[model samples]
Target: MLTLKGKSVFAGITIGPLALFHRNTISTASHTVENPEVEVIRFQKARDESIEQLKGLYDKAVQKVGEEQAAVFEVHQMMLEDDDYVDSVEEKIRNGKINAEAAVDQTAQELADMFRHMEDAYMQARAADVLDISRRVEQQLCGGAGIDFSKYDHVIIAADDLAPSETLQLDTDRILGFVTSSGSTNSHTAILARTLGIAAVVNTGNQLHNDVDGLMAIIDGLTGMVYIDPDEDTLSQMRIKQQEEKACKARLEQVRHVPTVTRDGRVIKLFANIGNPGNLPQVLANDAEGIGLFRSEFLYLENSDYPTEEQQFEAYKKTLEVLEGKTAVIRTLDIGADKQVDYFDLAPEVNPAMGMRAIRICLTRPDLFKTQLRALCRASAFGKLAIMFPMIISVAEVRKAKKILEEVQIELDEKAIAYDKDMEVGIMVETPASAVMSDELAKEVDFFSIGSNDLTQYTLAIDRQQTALDAFFDSHHPAVLRLIQQTIENGHKAGIWVGICGELGADLTLTETFLRMGVDELSVSPPAVLPLREKIRSLDLNKA
Candidate 1:
């Protein structure tokens, strides 16, 4: 029983034969070439071919995932055609008298290293894109056919790292799970894995071996374990687990259109956390009751400048329109630390995760905050809309944020722009301080939506994104649960609804416990909605 552990990006169980996915990296040993022009032609031909490949992959990915994600392929194609990339490769080939393959490899590494050195997390992620597209080009030059995934259905794939393009090109139906020795939970590969609903254990730190290829394996993404050639008893137990998973999924499908009400007639709202308007299709498909956390950070991440009110309003209004009459809690600008814009030009921090961010940025820059508030207020008239402030730790922060929101309302009213006058305002109870002082903060806000991801990180002093500390980052720790329960009680006492829109909310193990604790809502990723509802509907909370 050779067991490997990793960080789980998506939760599920899969028992399958192991398949090793290896990308053929072209060696860059400089071999003298006869004709430099011929080498340039080879590089250009390969580049064009890679672009065509991306276009085809984009079309297929659109069907498999969604438009926003599929657009990444287009971005890859553009990067390939970029002068920076093309000129660098051409210069290496012509000036250095190197072969096309060697020049491409050298240039790619240079650009990739540059991106990796960037302070911005988004730019750092782009480094993966550079390496990914370069690999595709290198594959084109080497005449290497991509991994034929069609041949290996129902297999757990182990790889050093999978580029987003490689993942999108895969026959996902054949892929039961993924175990990558190198990958962050925040990578595009992780996003695709979650979108495709595949169990993945990433950042295993190169512990996976080629010898394990074709060996039967159990990928327990929930626990982030990879079991290779388990004992008979363990295999038997895993098989039973696999059966239960399928049965649970089947049971969840029956309640697709049903309300998330406990057996004892307790009602709970189940909402989906969406990044942008493009996610609406999944939002409706998953039958999520509403959008609990409409992450507004994408506006800042996707743009090069501080987003204007008109730009922000269009995005907000589109989201509200899609939710139809359902509610959408738009968290205002959770930027800085992990999510930063170069335009913002925020200073470096010794500890960014706990530094100036989210509501902190908004409070200091009321100009930026008021713009988003005006947009949200205007969009509210289109559908049920709520404004949520992130990283709140006190009643003063909530009151201050609400004061700015009120100012925006007054400005809009004077300008004769129509909006929902009764739009609900809320604050994220993510910090230990906020959870502890929920009684006081609850009196200031219309509702309390606990951002358990940050709450867990803050309470346990764990960086939620750090794969190294996965073992210590316990979301279910009694300390965090006690805070959740207390916040719920406090919200109820103050006549405000309470919900959790974080990774912990999707945990089915705690669904019954949350219902028993009187949580009014469980907001999770769209994929988790139905399964969570199944758990909610099956629970006899009264009995518990």
Candidate 2:
């Protein structure tokens, strides 16, 4: 029995058979197989075979996992049909006169390289799909030579990396957990696994590969820890713990319909964090008090340029109609370094996270900013609407932004455009600078919403994206906690409400801490609302 240890990032544990996701290496010689016509035929055949295999995988996923889970394959299907991708491969074959394998490999590398160079982590992750597709094509050309885990009953996948499409194809019931050599929590594979409630640990180094196969392992999804060949006592304890967790979760769900009031009768609002209109049904189902962070970036991304005033208005109005009287805090376009819009002529910046993003872009491009504000104001007439500014660093930025908003309001009034003049305006306290100056900022703004993700990042000067920096990026760090406390104090001092819209707001461990810190509201993922609400209802605020 070998003992291997890793940091436990996520908390639940499961023991099962181990499934390994081995890496594929394709070697093609450009100098060999000089016949261009024959090579082209070979490439076509390989591509066709790979398409069939992907379709087979898709069908299996639908049959076993259901359509919603298998929907990730749609991107793969789109890639196969992409005329640009196909043309590029064909052009390479024709010009280089290389073997079909060489041409396909070259094309795949080019696509992967392009995606890898993209600033957005999400987009950069898409490069894995290109490589995955290329590998499938190579396997087909080689008569499908790869490890077959179809016989494994319960397995934990060990891989250097797994693409979203590939990860979705696993028979999750048979597959217990996954340990990857490299991946971030934000990677699609990790995100999908979390959505499916599968246990996963990424960036566990290469040691996981050695003991992964045939190892009776206990994986903690929340903590990202893998207990290899656990002793009988540990295994029994883990089983008991798992059952208790399930019961606790079920109990938490029972309070879904309950109001969030502390023992002393102080009410705390629990709202949902939403990215798009698709999340509205779930938000309603979870009985969220309101929409806290309606990230409007999704709508902006699906289009080329800035969405028209009418287009933006319609989207916001639809969301408002769903929530009706409940307050929907619509955050203005937060696009910048991490997210890119094709239509916007944004210059590439060295450090986009700290560069012109969020309100910075809005302040610089007043015309674009006004269009969004106009749409938001128009939508405010249908339901309760609050405007939220993201990445606010200084009081002057807030003053300037509000001034522009006032100008927009005056224009709307002159044109007799229906709007809500009394709409509450808020700023996201995401920077350490903003958090420290919260008292002054609270005086200027109606409310404060601590974006803990960015706040922690900025306060500690730790890049959350770098796994090595994870130690310093903790939300529970003393400095981070102090900043949050100060922000809350400032808001209360100015008689303004404050809330948290980051992942910390949803964390079970820190939920009580946040409540004690006098957070007026907690905005989290739609699914987390009920349990968090229950936690709030169970708290004794008077004692605190």
Candidate 3:
């Protein structure tokens, strides 16, 4: 029997039949064809059939899950309708003069190659989606049906990777867990698994499939561990532990509506981090105090150019209307080397993370910065709106950004546009330099929100994106803890509130540590708010 172990982020254990996802190998023709028009036609027909199948899948998802939960598929639907993507395929078919199937295959390969060349990991991941859709099309053209796993009683899905659509087809009653060769905790597969309450492990290495089929194996999702041919004693213990864990989670939900105050009567505000305006419903459902981070980069990415003031106003207003009376801390555009905007005409830098990004970008492009400020200020008149800047390294940049904001406010006044002049402004302390200079920056900004994810990466000089160095990027390192403590102290000394808007704030294990460090607010994923509130309510602040 073989054993594999990794850090456990979520907890659960299950034993089931293994269903592995192996990569499909494409066999291309050896001879080069002069005219491939016939292949292109065939490819187009296949692509159309795949689109229809995807539509059917969408309908099934809506029927199984509520429309709101299934709304994630809308982007996939749009991809099919995208003019540029369709044109690219047509151009290849006409120019290359290849067979329809060959043309489709070649075009798909080109699209994937283009995305892979981009610097952003998020964009690079999109290549997988493109390849997945093309493969589905190819299968349909060849009259190939997906593998049937309906007979399995309890099964575990093992795959090179699972796309959102592929995951939705899972037989929940029979599928108990998932193991993938490549994926991340933040990927769509992981998100779907969490929502479905299924156990999953990614990046398990290639050797796992040696004896996977028909093997009686046990998997612990929380720890990302797999045990082959577990002894009866181990299985029995796992079952008992699983039941106890479920009971604990159920108990945690009982305090969903409770206040987050320590045993000694210290209040700690908890909010939710939102990626887009569409997520407002979930945030409201969790009874979040307000939004901690409203990432505005999505608007920039969806469009070819910068979003107009009216468009920005509409998005901001919708969030404020939904959260009415509560605070909504809206973060400005954070595009940089990692996130590219085609309209921005940005030059590629060797070290994007260290290059011009966040507040730095805004400083360089004040006109774009002013437009966002105007929209935000106008939206603030309707509700509590707080402006938060990202990737701030020094006080000088904060002061300069504030000057532009003031100029925007003056322009609004000249135009007789009503706005809130008293709206508070804050900075994201994600860099070691910012953390060390918190005492200076605290005096300039109204508040501070520690971005522990980036802060830890910078402090330890480790690239979190590089899997080989993930071990050294520990958030609990003494250096990270000290920085958090000092930042909180500096903010309090300057008579301003300090909060955390990073992944660490939502972590169950570090809840006590943050409370002890005197963090005033904790912003996390919406699903975690209630549990965190309950933890805060149970804590004895004075004891800490």
On TM-score, the leading prediction is: 3
- Model 2 misses residue 350 by how many Å? 5.2
Q: Which stretches of candidate 1 lie over 4 Å from their true place?
A: 9-12, 22-25, 31-45, 81-100, 111-125, 142-156, 173-177, 198-200, 207-213, 277-282, 307-311, 410-416, 436-440, 456-486, 507-517, 538-544
lDDT of each structure? Answer: 0.86, 0.79, 0.78
User: Worst ten-residue run, lDDT, model 3?
Assistant: 23-32
Report the Cα lDDT for residue 13, model 3: 79
**Tens digit per residue, CA lDDT, model 2, 99-209:** 777777888899889977877765677777787787777777666776555655677777777777667766677877777766656555665675556677777776455
* Cα lDDT, model 3, residue 321: 88
lDDT of 3 at 442: 97
The per-candidate count of clashes, in order, stands at 0, 12, 14
lDDT per residue as tens, model 3, 171-243: 7777887777665564445555665667777667754665667677677876688776777887787778778
lDDT-better candidate, 1 vs 2: 1
Q: Clashing residue pairs in candidate 1, if any?
A: none
lDDT tens digits, residues 1-544, model 1? 8888888978888888888886555676788887899999999999999899989999999988978678788888888988988999999898888899899888888988887776565677677888888888888998957876576678888888889977776677778888988777767888788778888999887656678889998888778988889999999988898788788778878999987888889889999998877678778988999999999988888675778889998998888777779999888899887876778888989889999899999999998888889888888889999989999988888889888888988888799999998888899999999999999998898999999989999999999879899888788999999999999999999999999999999988888788888899889989889988888888886583
Error of 1 at 148 (Å): 4.5
